[model samples]
Target: MPGHGSNTESMETASAIVSLITASVAIWKTIDAAICSIKNAPARIQHWRAINRLLQTSLSRMEETMKRRKGAGLSISERKHYESIREHLQCFKDDLEDLQHKIASVALPRRFGKRTIPRQVLTALEIKLQEDPHLEKRVDRNIQLFQLSVALLSLLDPAPRTSVRPILTELHALHLQVSDDDDKLRKWKESAHDIAKDAAMREIGFTSSATDRVRVGRQPSINIQPTPQRDFGIDENFNKEELLHKIKVTQDLATRLEEAGMPTIASNFQLDAIKCGEQLREMHDHPLDMAEYVSLEERYILILISCQSYEEASFQIALNRLNDLASKVDDTSRNELFRERQTIGTLYAKLQDINSAIHFLRIALFDGYLKQQDLLAYDAEIRQTSRLLYEVYECSGMWPDLEVTKKRVRDEFGEDPVASSVEISKALGWCEKKGFTVSERDRQLYFNPLTNENGRTSLHEAALDPKMDMDVLRYLMLPEYYSLRDDSGDTALLLAADRSNYNVVEMLLTIPYLVHVRDRIRRQTPLHRCKDKRTLDLLIEAATRRNSIPPGTDWEPVDINSADCSQRTALHLACQQGRVDLVETLVAHNANVNATCLTGETPLVLACWAADTAKPALEAIVRELVSHGATWEQKFPVRRDPRKRLKARGFSNSDISELTRQPGSSTESSEVEKDASILMHLDS
Candidate 1:
């Protein structure tokens, strides 16, 4: 028993020893594992701390620079710096993330006891080295240490219970500040780009105002500058001239382009410019000399006078400039200046600026005569201009100027010394002093048989004038000039008769000798020439006087119904003119109404011809003709046999009707035989 007991005790002691050894080994392994974890914890925590510090530093620098740059107003250079910083910050963040990943993959397993540490003491020593900086009284280092400690504690199975929430909240706040600063920087950079583009646009003369840019839908706008070739000169006068020249050049270019078969897009503007230049030139060269410069000035005035609207505006401005220049010219240059003034006045007249034109003309006239001491030559154009000025001034109620112009005209031409309101007898006396002669025959002027451009006597012009004065007519109708004829063989009587001049007609009748005169048309007497009531009455009175001859008078009654060419008598003309009164008067005087013309048309046929006449007159004439036994029937001439009545029926034997039945036949015959007999009888 003792041996057994001893054996059991030995077994128990052995068992206890084994258990103690096992427990010690276990404790050793556990301590070793804890030490390993603590060792690896420093490296892991150090890596996390470095990564967090790097990330925080990068974000802090970025945020601060971004804020500073935004406050400073970012320029292009500053924006580039911000972009660099952003790239660097992104790279730093990427590196930090890489480091975190490396720490997690390589160190976390070993520190958590899943693997063995490759270098325990080195990692611990590194953590100790990092701790010294924290311990050196640096706030950032201290923060890093705090963060590292917290990170390591989090990895521990029994982590420290102390709250890390406050630290996390601070980090979050920093992140938010950085984010806001980045946003501000981005906005600043964009604005700077826009401003730079606008400046560029302004430099190009592209009207880069904000409103205009917006209107054009420009974004990130760049300014467009005008090309040097397109730049117009700065001087207003020069610009106008340049524009004119450019237009002219453009027109020429356009013409060339058209010749070349190129499009005329650019040349059209050139043409407009050329026209403007021409107008400006014209306006610049105003009043021209009539004697030495009429032809050129006339053309210039014509061009200027034809302009319309805005084109005319330039012309007006040029004219004003010319006038202004003229006003400043010295008086010694008055003669030369007067020429210019005359030209200007002429232009103004053409432009319908009558008052201004007249004003200049009067000044010119006065300068030519009074001041310049030169006799102003009488010219048709000058007289015409002066006359127009007078009329225009008169209509505008500028009577003083009108009178002045009229006096100038009279002085230049021959002045009429007779009083304007003189009596006819007094005027005649004045005319006698002027060597004017009067005739008791046709009341017309007797001159030296002066011929006009067409070789017509001057009296022809007077006769052609519808408003010719009776006194002039009387003065022209003297016996010595009664034989005068125009180029058209029109005598004074023919003219007076043609114009239906009643007063002239009566005055002409006073000359009994002219009553027997005829024109070149041959035998066309004044009585034969009457077409109207006034001339016809005069002719009738003359005829009656001739018919009621005085005692022992040698005068014989003239035939009033005498015919001329076409065998038309005075009665035919009267009827044709629808003159009922003249016709009745002539008919009462035993005038022949049935007189046939050369065309075989009687007065009755002429009266009924196509014209508007009084129905009563036509009826009376017809009745009188009928009462005179005039027949309406027309008898055809017998060109065939005179003894045979069948010739009047216009049929021969061959032309007889082929019908067997003849309802209106006067004689009976067999059908075929009757037809042949009728044909033969008709032929006979």
Candidate 2:
């Protein structure tokens, strides 16, 4: 009897196994036919086909196993899997039917305007397919059409809406529908809740551009940003090639992470991302922008700062660090290299902290760097800093402060006013690069009320400051301002040339009319105020070129020998100041070697008369002058013993000379005799 009973159970289990395998095959055939009918689907629909194909593989594997084991009594696991499969097939029976019916319409003739079906059911099927092996355990055999709809809707939402909201809505609807008594409703609703949010988020991952509205979820584990491009704005201050390289490396890491499965960018890509992040942090802390490697360390310590807040914390931190830097330099000097302070200040301005921006701007204007700079190179620190300062003030409606900032610029350019009281920065140059234009507000702020409270024009204010932002200057600069001199009789060229602003000098020299523009005091020309050798060379070269002046126009190049009010020529000033380079440059350019000042001192004599402290430079200038045919022969007496008359002529004797006599032979004696003869004649 026991053997017979066991045999009956075995037969029944075999029948059940065969029936489950048949049911799985039947549904898989339905899905396979639907997939075959849908031809050349769009990417969105193709995934539906792919999931169905994978499902067919799972079903085929199951059927083949059942066939091999047909008539064998079911093992514990096998019976469980057999029941699970039967339940899974029953749960999705309607979904498979719906897909089978809809897919033929998708495959309809093109002439019939090709029909389509909803992808929600396909997506839900795909989601369940990915969770295989355990599918039977979780498959709710009594799943209703509404439960399928809820799950399909969750997976369909590209934004996924929110993980909690949709799940809550489904749960609430299920609660009202079942009165909390329907266990199958409860069972399937829990199952939907488990997979819906995650499934929706995964759907979003497939669409990286989707907003990923899963509010409480982690940062979308996928990169949604499109590839970085090379198009850059003026805001980029770092090396562009390096920036691009950094971005590319980052992108490569993201690609690797995505290629592997990820919770965080998986496997080696996670490592790469971590290392890259570490490298970025290291770079953020210590920027290494060395070309030759000689100036590597400490070059870019504070050039950039990242801020999360717009309030004073960041600004204050930056300033304190800057002060710490200055303290390292000197406990009391209270200065950083201008580039450092300017970066922090510019960042403050970007963050819209006006006062902090102004404060940093003020701190950045250390007289050390600016005092040494004449004509700045393109993109010089001072130029950028000043531009930022002007923008900050103007944007903040601090016109008075903006105007006051124009004075801070005054500190940047100072050549010697020892010979003339003209402010070097106030005398600036402006011409244009071809086809450049500035807005009207830029013109007013940069170039505006014609003249300041002092008689200096907007052009004067523009001169040293643009630092060679030539495009705007091209628009702002016009011929009217060329001849407009301030009360001090300074032209922009005179200012630029005076500052030895090479770029300004080079640009201003482009306009033929500006080469010889002179200042009122001492009647000195740009040539007279030019203290830099390169600038002097440029001026001399420009003077030699033909002035595009019309044949009858009174335009004439200022004579290389034109004298100032002191009767001092450019060469005379060069020699007098013991500027060996300037004197060499001038002499080489054919400046009159024997040009005399109001006191009748020749270039050789003036050079020889340079202070004993300037003995070496004086010797060099004397040699340069003499080599260019300067003579010691003085036709006039020592006009009031030059040194004695210096103090009375608004000159400082201490600054000019500590007179020293030189030992000489007969040639010098004869010169002394002539000097005595002139003195005797003056006495008579």
lDDT of 2: 0.47
RMSD of each: 50.2, 35.9
lDDT tens readout by residue for model 2, 554-582: 23458578887788898877777767777
- Measured with C-alpha atoms, the lDDT of residue 419 in candidate 2 is 12
What TM-score fits each model?
0.27, 0.30
lDDT of 1 by residue, 362-395 (tens): 7765565334333345344454445445544643
lDDT of each: 0.42, 0.47
- What is the overall TM-score of model 1 with all chains considered together? 0.27
